[model samples]
Target: MHILALVLVVLPLAASQLIGGPTTVDVNRDDVQQMASFALTQLNTLLGSQNTLVSVVQAKTQVVAGIKYFLTLDIKNGKETQTCTVTVWSRVWLNDKQVTQHACTSRTKRDGLVGATTSVNVTRTVLKMATYAVTTLNGLQGVHNSLDQVISAKTQVVSGTNYFLKIRMSDGSQTQICDVTIWDQPWSYMTQMTHHSCVNAKRRDIGMPGGLFNADINSPDVKNMTNFALGELNRLQGAQNSIIEVISAKTQVVAGMNYFLKIRMSDGSQTQICDVTIWDQPWTHMTQMTHHSCVNAKRRDIGMSGGMLNADVNSPDVKNMANFALGEINGVQNAQNSMVQIISAKTQVVAGMNYILTMRLKEGDKTQICYVKIWSQPWLHRKEMTEHSCSQVTKRAGGLLGGVTNLNVNSGDIKEVAKFAVREINGIQGAQNSLVKVVKAGYQVVGGFTYVLTLSLKDGDKTQLCEVNVWSPAWTMARRLTDHHCTAQTKRQLAAVTDADVNDHFIQMLAHYAVQTINTLDGTHRAYVELISAKTQVVDGTNYFFKIRVRQGTTTQLCDVTFWRQVWMNSMGHVTEHKCATVRRRNVGGVEPAHLSAPLQQAVSFAEDALNGKMNSMFRFVVEKVENISQKASSATTYSFDLHLVSSTCRNNGNSYGKGITDCTPNYGMLQRMTCEVTVEYRPSSSRKYSLAADKCGQIQLV
Candidate 1:
């Protein structure tokens, strides 16, 4: 009869109850919902008839003497969905359910926070009293605490009235935020400062962390020193690393000037955060790293294994140790030698982040690549620049130039590198493709030598291109492909992506979809035959070049098709045909022929009628592109012509079919872009219709 019974009977009991255990049950389970319903009714009854049951939003069950339901209910309490927490004990078998504790909050009236009513607005009277209380505290503690601002306050009515205040002090640095209490009884003519204390983070310096200060993040001196530290790291660590830009910088003057920098640096292709410290002593011409640590873009440690491991130019240990080393170098040169770049470096942890490096550094206008080694411990505040040798950096061939790049490919070294990469090819992809020749080659020095070779691999009768990077050390004959990508070619080549066969069903489907999408622009219903050939070039995305055979009416023809949709699009069933063409497709479609035959006139008529039927009901339209396909003399498919049709509109056209919309656009939503089709041929007499024309799905003339 009550709302609780109405709710309980409506919900089906779906939760399995286990006896003698507390279980977490889905809140939406029917049994939980049913329990929630009963709990809400009991809550209403226990709390008088004031609060009404809105909905049972959550429930937790404990199997006790019967079942105890910990319920959080959204009640109809005049305001928005205010929450009412209710706990109920139920023995459904005995049909006995009681609202154990209706609120979770005290069910009975209770004084708030030991009988003090809190208020946020600190009146002038409250502040004056708080000041007096603080004064009493200061006199007793032998300190000064002038009031700045009131944070919070509480008032209690006793024989007279008392005020407790929390405030920020204007004078005291450590005890900025403190609590003070004052007893006031004006009728009895009594006033006394009773309490003074501190709470939470504000107990000291208003919750600020120790030894932390804000500094200009874009300080120039900081940048220069930070850059100097990074350059030195690349040297000592033998890393090809460079800074992107500075994020933040701070400086402290101690034994010298210590720079604290946070910056983004590039270690090969990865960009990471480098927290670097560069200690510079210009007066003594000494500069070196104190510390350098790197974290990923997410500000999480990169988990670099410790050792004399190869590190980025931004590695904390490398940077700091190098800074110390550089400072010592400056002291030795006394010529203000500044680091330009690190050519190569190797470091092994000894006392601290220490390094032996070959570096390109600048002394005034002159720069030299030098062999330098340095070691230091920041805690000891000492360093030793052990070795230094230099030669002016010169432009020369056969020298180790930095970075991965395209270089001369006709050299003897190129040939050797190609052969080396080829020798390791069998281990690559474990496929049947054999190397015919190397298409191109580039090299970079990384500990050893790495060659990026674009190879022409032969698989069956197909020739596909595979680009692989092979790493080979100078001495050993062992060479390994670090990375590679090879594609499939019809019967000619097949990519061995982990030993998958060439006749994979997936490959065939892609081949078909790719062909149809290309011809879709021409609107020609050509049946796809066998795949003649298809090859892929790997770049940021794959470029698929396909040679597919398809049927037109009674004759079979070869179409050279190209598509740019992502390769995964085919497998994901989201293939969008971006581009397609017949064999010599580039030359296949172009300008409309010089003369239109009588049949061309009638065929053009049919095409216009079909397209116009699909257009907006209000206005007949003109197609922007007209492709002229005439029966060729030999094996040629069709020649196309691009015709730009001017539209008769008052405003400009930026491809709004969201171009010419409302009642003027095509009926099939917006026929935004039409690449192919609408082949209507009628050859009765020399009937010429001057008004008809189209685009990929454009212009028309009968043949």
Candidate 2:
């Protein structure tokens, strides 16, 4: 089976617990803070709620075509503040930013909070609702860690009663406190366990001590035979029942395998303990419930308005439901977590059936434990994954073999391997190439992770590309540089396209993205000035190498940027390689692009005023080149411009901006002498004016 190489998606929700993800970042940082606030802003716009951001609780970042931020934000909703989670994806290069999966942290706050009572008045009806909540919990989970007496309860009345309770719970031995919330309306026979969280969430396998004679309720085979009998029992009584669990069950080989089971079940209002017998003949595909007994129940005919049936996950209809759940979750979840197996399942009869499935999902080389609730009405061809939650299954540190893997270039592990490769190469005896950063990257999974990378190295005064391969067996904690080679890029070469092709929208887009990535990685802040040339190469995926001109405050620089995209492997393909080194030029001229935006034109006009203000020069600005104008602070902007002249004029006697009238003593305000450069900061909010910052102005006169 060919598995898609694009597995660098969101980690399961559970994995994003107190910490965000493997790539956790500080919540206070400007970028992360911006994302958190933006998520709330988008939430306000989409949900039409003016919930302002209170604080960023946590942040998890994934490096895609842009940065994908998984944020936990605290927001002031109204009277009570709520903690919410959201995903914000941003590709600053393409000028695209979006918010997805914006929601409250807990269902209690997320749903039915509008009219829900703030405090609970424990009336007689409230106690009954608590009992109903426990009954439903016992049905879904089985006898294992069965819910018991409710120590306390908080109720929210939204059409139905919602119970948030701290309950006494125990599997077989130790009792623990479980905070569970459920929605119930006895008249409608609707009881759903909305949220379940425990203080000690981890539990050991409750299988019997090393002995074959002891019954193992956790065994799937035992569950299959037990639930099969339960299904038959429900059908017989004309009653819908939910299984608390198969408390104790063992199989015996006779005419067919005989299953003796002790199960816990609930019928809407009360819980029951049942002893059942079943004959399972796998060869004939037949399973029959022989006899059954329940505590304090003389009548074998109990009628429940509507109830849940403990389902053998392997059964035909139940298996179909599980598959339905998988499809729905994968469709909605940005991370494509495919089903590995149905660990357990239960079906509640509603208009059709509601299947609550606990499944094992495969994400990359890891396994995730998922709980998905699906409502599927096949007759109506309607199905939805109602609720989903998954947590990363921690694997013991050891050998993990995988197939051809196309992973995220920005993954923590991927970058670690790339850095290791650089450390290995730079330390090589008499190595001439001093590598700086990873420009482009790809990887394969063999023993551990095999990283294929293109690196930019500082070779004398020029920037060069180096291809390096590193094999790191993460299990063994070892790294090795298997092979390495370097290439000194000569003058710009258009391999697959002519100079005219550089203007192609597709090419220009890639060029712009590459230049953006370089600016982000480069120490000095810069923006794109010109795309001098671009080359495309066809390989397993497309390879784009571009030579672009960028400026950092009054500094002119040339950078070679390489971008690799395997049909959006992880993002707009990842910025595989980026190299930027300032080119020192004397009397260097500037080139102008075809068009500029309105904001950019306004920025230049402001820049002229600032220049004329700072330097007593009537600056008749020659419109040499206008590259880009990007927002710096909330109200400020950074614009890149090429200067033709900045002659100092002592007075502003009604002289329009950019026009120099009188020559000053050449001693006023710093006359920055550089080849050709200018930086403008526009703050229209605070001071409706621009401040001038220039470089290499006096040395190379703009002709």
Candidate 3:
């Protein structure tokens, strides 16, 4: 049966009458013949047999197939044709039995046509699946091309504007859209065509602004898209798989200050855009703000009134406030100077007869300033002046007599002048002779009344003369005479001179009464004389006096003693005074006295008292009294004694034999028995005492 059907369907062409009129068909029309042949070729390929169906033209514009009218082809001539809707139908044959039939219609066309009918062989077709696929691919390519243009334009805009861009796909089933970005240069084609199945199935809406579509080719948006596509291509090149969605970026200014921007993808996910600006000194931003822009949208947010942005900010760490205050204080302290004048002094006497006086000065109550000059003339003279002498003497000497005179006041006061003259006179006198001798003569007014003189005169015409004259005040003259000349000289000669003389003539005379006293005894029952010698010797041809005091017991009976001597060269080669009595007791006792020098009398008195008791105990004596022997040479003396009873009492203390004296016998002993011999010598012609002893005398002593 299938083979009979195939043979009957493969017959040659035949014609049928039209219902309206007889219509001719062009079997070889160029357009009609080509379409018919194409339709038949497709049918044969699909059925795997060349004779799958037979087409018969029953009328001029109608074609019939084995089981159904497959198609009606018409060629019409008109200015404007009616709406023509053409239906296409097909029947399927399996094992020579009809299985099913299908039909499809072409869209109605109302455009004008200018072609005539032609006899054409026709085959019907339900829409071909390969054609639909080809159509879909072509549509995708077209959409991609258009979208690439849009993306390129948007990228250029976005890149120039410092923005980022992305595209996505979505399915409308979920509340949140699932998005897939094409990641190619063009996003619109993927949006419209490649994603059509998802778009159509979900009936999803795509959102992209018309202004974005009109973006400048050179804009940053387009550039961003270009960059996005390039990056995605690089990511997908090896694996060809990657997810695309929202893109994100961040920017910061200061730590807490910055700008943020967000863009939403088609899937309702968001991207962040950030820009950072760091602010230091002299910071500046390149973009300018305009009136139309929001505060954050402005290129530079500085100098605006309403936001948290600040321009020309300053730091609080480096302000200098204290230095200005110190400058003011220093300016006031440089203007004050009145506390600086002398306070007290201490002094010490140094060598060269000068005194060192230190005067302390003060700045205030507590500060001591040293090295100030405070003392005046008199104190200066007492303190610092050296003792000196003027070699030249006054022509007319004799003003105030010898105490201290010739007080030549040059620049100093009375005290200074007096001190100067006293020291001068003393120095001159001391250079000539012993100061003791010069003071002995007392003060003499000489060389007229203009000068005072101190004379040191020797017995042989050697004289040391010091002349002092005061041209001014008398007190100065008196001070010079007393302090330096008479006062010092008297002190030096104090042992030799009497207190009377010292009080009457020397300055500071009260000092003499304190000297130690000397004692003496007289065997002749008369007062003994005291002589005090000077420690120093006189110069050549000079004379010195020994001071004398005659006392009876504790009473000073008389002081009327003079010192006189005969000048003689002694055997010891020294010229000293020879013996003679120069002073005597004024009242006399009844006994006639042997004439002896006062020195000899004093020596005799000393020996008598010292030996009196011992001698009396050793010898027995009657009523005969002791006396000075006479009737001999003036330098020699002899004694005689008469003994009457030869008694044991006359023995010398039971050790020797001697004649005893009766009541009327004279108590004179032999001159040899009463005297012992002694000789004293000294070298260099000085007076010093040496001791002499008697052999077997059992301690004979000399003074």
Question: Cα lDDT of all candidates, in order?
Answer: 0.52, 0.57, 0.24
Task: Show model 3 residue runs off by greater than 4 Å.
Answer: 1-482, 486-503, 507-537, 540-544, 550-703
TM per candidate: 0.23, 0.22, 0.14
lDDT of 3 by residue, 210-308 (tens): 111112222222224334433322232222322221122222111111211222111113211212111111113122100011112221212112211
lDDT of 2 by residue, 383-426 (tens): 88887776677655533444334557667877787767766665
Q: Candidate 1: how many backbone clashes?
A: 52
User: lDDT for model 2, on a 0 to 1 scale?
Assistant: 0.57
Of candidates 2 and 1, the better by lDDT: 2
Best by TM-score, which number? 1
